[model samples]
Target chain A: MDVLLTSTAEAFRLLFSGNPEIWEIVGISFRVSSMAILAAVPPALVIAFTLAYGSFPGRRFLISLFNTFLSVPAVVIGLTLFIILSRQGPMGDFKLLFTQTAMGLGQFFLCLPILVCMAHVSLQAADRAAWETARTLGANRLRAFFTVLYEIRFGLTAALLAGYGRIISEVGASMMLGGNIAHYTRNIPTAIALETSKGAFAEGIALGIVLLFLAFVLNSLLQYVQGKGSINP
Target chain B: MIENFRIGFREISKSFGSNQVLEQTAISIASHDCIVITGNNGAGKTTLLRIIAGLEKPGHCEISLDDASPEPWRRLRKRLLKSVMYLHQQPYMFAGSLLRNIEYAARLNPALADRESSVQKAVSWAGLEGLESQSAASLSGGQKQRVALTRARLCHPQVLLLDEPTANLDSESRERTLQMLREFRDSGTAIVIVTHDPGVFSDLATSKLHLQDHRIQADDIGAADVVELDSVRQSKKR
Candidate 1:
């Protein structure tokens, strides 16, 4: 307990002391995760909307498939991409192995199912009247779609926050794909792993503190958004 | 102002799996006409209204406009959408101020050359002048109905389809809705109301129809008739 307390205190000092190395890792984590999420949102929303509102064959199958993907282990995703991006594999021609792009690619696939399933739930919970109302008021199909999106904005925001929280803290995919290359692809989770393995618990604890803070912030935001949308809140 | 029009929605067939709601239903609507449709629960009165408003797709549908050639319902969806508006039994308000809700319809109408002034006029027309800044969700059922009417006023649809506009309102709200609807009829817009209480609209309804056995029956607005609508030959003799 004494060692743990000392390490936590030292971690805070390192975090607040303008440590270039730690913040660089933080920056890389945010940049890669932000890009991954930004690329995933639009397609996820479309798929989610289709799954919720569209009537066609295989819709239930797709919904089940995405829900299944939500439980996939992060390290499994890392290993699959590692094999695919290896020189002996098909996509090796791109030479994307051990690069930030590879790490981003891994994170992208990781968060896409999360965004789809959650956004699908959000769309399903929304009233069908908003769409009909907009269309009957002379809005084209596209405009009506936007109107419905606005109506469910709170739920969508919560989905986004949940998705961002998932991708930003995952260490397995970043470790295998990025190889923890310092100052290039090394992110918070990867750096924390390396630091702890090397017995540098202070830095590791500092990064852990950041993750905890982020989780708290995200959960708080999610609570507020859900509260605003609830009828009894 | 909306141009006068006569629309015939012919051969509408809708079913939910094994349960058929409407089969070979037909109805004709013309400008300045107030049509009140009554039927038992589950008789598909709302379904027929939605079909006329182009909000639902019937199994096989055709339409004739102003005595023109009959066209496939799918082909004239945009035209129907432009000229028809359907108000729900309980008005669904968007998440915004009342002004925003009114402005939403105003924006969709490209004919409103000056959107701001048109919205202001509509707000005042609905007697919602002092409540423009209030949240739409907080309004009573009557105010919501007025807001829906305001939205219809801005759109100026030739056909306004209302589903139980007075079902959940108090007496005052019901009277106010009727007054507004009377004004809508006087402005040359065709009003089609689906209600359980046909007697409520007797003073203003130009015609009344009954939906039974998956069909809308009767011929004239001023006549008291309820016959099966096997194949309504809704030919406009104009």
Candidate 2:
């Protein structure tokens, strides 16, 4: 406990001093997660709308398949991508292993199911009248689709927040696929893991503090977008 | 009857699982005419209107305009969407102001010139002058109806399918709605209004249809009759 107390104080000092290592890690974390979400959102929305409103063969089967995938463990996803990116695996020709892109690819898959599941629920709960009304108002399929999407914009925003939250703090895929290389792919969560294993609790504590702050900032932004947070600041 | 357009529906049917609604039904609507559809609750009146509006596809059905008959439903799909507009019992508002809802339809129509003026005219025509900037969700029932009417008017569809438009309105609102329908009819828009209130539609209906037992029966209400048949039926208690 005494060690923990001193280490926490040192962590605060490192954080307040604008440590370069901490900043680099935080920046990498943000870049990878943001890119992954950007890649995931469009496809997630398309899949979700198709599942919710479309009438086609195997729709029920596809929905059930996605629902089953919703519970897939993150470590399982990391392992699956690890093999796929490895030299002996099917996708090894690209040699994307141990790169930021590989980690991002894993994170993209992780975020997609969350987005599709939540957005599908949101679209299902939406008023059917909106779609029919848009159609009858002389909107073709494309125009009516956009109108329905607008009606559910708030829910879409929430889906994005949830997806971002899921990927930003994830450590498993980043460590495995990114190799946690310092100055290249080391993110906050990976740095915290490395520091804690090495008994450098100050760096670990410092990275943990930054990660917590990141979570706070993300949640604050989300609440503000949802019209639930303080506007004073 | 107008030669250029006539809405034809043939042998349309629909069901939800084991429960059937419309079963092998047909109807034809001409331009500048008003048809009142009447039935008891769950008698498929709304379903028929939905099929006519092309919002719901019939189980075994075909529809067309003019004399394009026998499997012309495929051809009807394209024209059905352009020439028909449906008004729900409780109309839905797009996510913005009243003006946006009207202009949304106007934007899609390539022929609507002076979009802003067209929206303004629709608003004023519906007697909704000052509520332009308000969110459509905040409007009263009658105001919502008028907004929906304004949307339909801006689209300028040749056929309008209304499902229980006056079901929830007050007497004054109902009268205002009927008056608007009269005006639209005068401007040569074919209207198929579904209502249980016979008094509201008596004067405007060129014909009356009653759906019962999954079949459409043309009622004996004469074109000149103005009696409230629904009210009289209600007093007799079935």
Candidate 3:
């Protein structure tokens, strides 16, 4: 108990004392994760919208496939990308094996399914009348699509927050793809792992606090957005 | 004001899986026309209206405009979408102020030179004054229906297809909706209304049709009361 308390206290000290190294790892995590989620959102929304609204062959199969991807372990994705991006692999021409771009690529795949599946669920729960109403009101198909999106804006925001939370906190993918290099590719989760393994409990605990605080903030945001949309849902 | 025009949709066929909802049914709408359609639930009354509005894909259909040569429905669908508007049984209000709802329709109408005044006038025309800033989604059934008409009023669609415009309204709301509809028809906007209570629209309905056997037929006025309920159920079973 004393050890835990001591490390936790020192962790806050390091966090608030303008620790450059700790903040750099935090910056890498956010930059990679933010770019990944931003890149994943548009394509995920299109896929989810197609699954929810379009009627075509294999649509149901595609929906099921995405839902299945939601449960896939992050390590599995990390390993798959690692092979594909390795020196001898098909994509090896890029030579992006142990870089921030690799970490971003891993996180992108990790969050794509999450955004797709969750957005699909939100669109499914949306009122069909929204689409019909927009069409009848002289909106073209594209305008009508945007109208429906606006109707379910709160739900989509929730999906976005959930996707960001999952990718940012994931350790396995960042560690495997980013290689946990000191100040270059290192992120919060990778740094936590390295610090803990080196018996540097204070550093690990500080990073854990950041993750925990982030989880709390994201969940609070989710709850607030859900409350705004609870009536529609 | 809408331009004087006529549209004839021939051979509208729509099916959901094995269920044949509409089978080569036909209908026509001309300027200043009020066509009322009556049928039991699942008789595809709404489907026919939707097809006329170009909001649904038909198995096959053809459209002829103003004595012109017949063209495939797929070809004329864009024209129909531009000129026709369909109102739902329970009107859906966008997620914002009532003013925003009216503003949306005004924005779609490129011909409207002054959108601000046009929208304001429409709000007053629908008796929706003092409620401009309120969330439209929170309005009562009657208020929502009025807002829908207000939107229709702004766009000036050549044809308006409404599904049960007075389904659950009290007498006051029904009267308000009928008054607005009467003005729409007078302004040369063709009106197609699908209702269980066709009697309410008796004054304005220029023609009445019954949906039966997956077809639209000129309704025999007295015969409908006796044969409608049983025949509709029988047709569903077929």
Give Cα-based local distance difference scores for all models: 0.89, 0.83, 0.89
- Which candidate would rank higher by TM-score, 1 or 3? 3
Q: What digit string (tens of lDDT, one per residue) describes model 1 on residues B1-238?
A: 4577788888889998999999987787888778889889999999988888888988888899987998989999888888899999988999989999999999998988999998998888888999999989999989999999999999999999999998988898888889999999888898999998887887778767888999887735433323222222132211
In candidate 1, stretches whose alpha carbon ends up further than 4 angstroms from where it belongs are: A230-233, B219-238
Clashing pairs in 3: none
Task: Evaluate candidate 3 and give its CAPRI docking class based on DockQ.
Answer: medium
Best prediction by DockQ = 1
Q: Interface RMSD, candidate 2? A: 0.9
> What does the lDDT come to for candidate 1?
0.89
Q: State the TM-score, rounded to 2 decimals, of chain A in model 3.
A: 0.97
Candidate 3 local lDDT, A1-233, one digit each (tens): 99999999999999999799999999998999999999999999899999999999999899989989999999999999999999988999999989999999999999999899988988898888899888888999999989989998988898899899999999998888889999889999999989999999999999999999999999999898879866673
C-alpha lDDT of residue B56 in model 3: 89
Write candidate 2's Cα lDDT for B86-153 as tens digits: 99999999877888887887787778789888878888999998888997878889889988888888
Error of 1 at A144 (Å): 1.4
Question: In model 2, where do residues sit more than 4 Å from their true spots?
Answer: A225-233, B1-4, B72-75, B221-238
- Ranking of predictions according to DockQ: 1, 2, 3
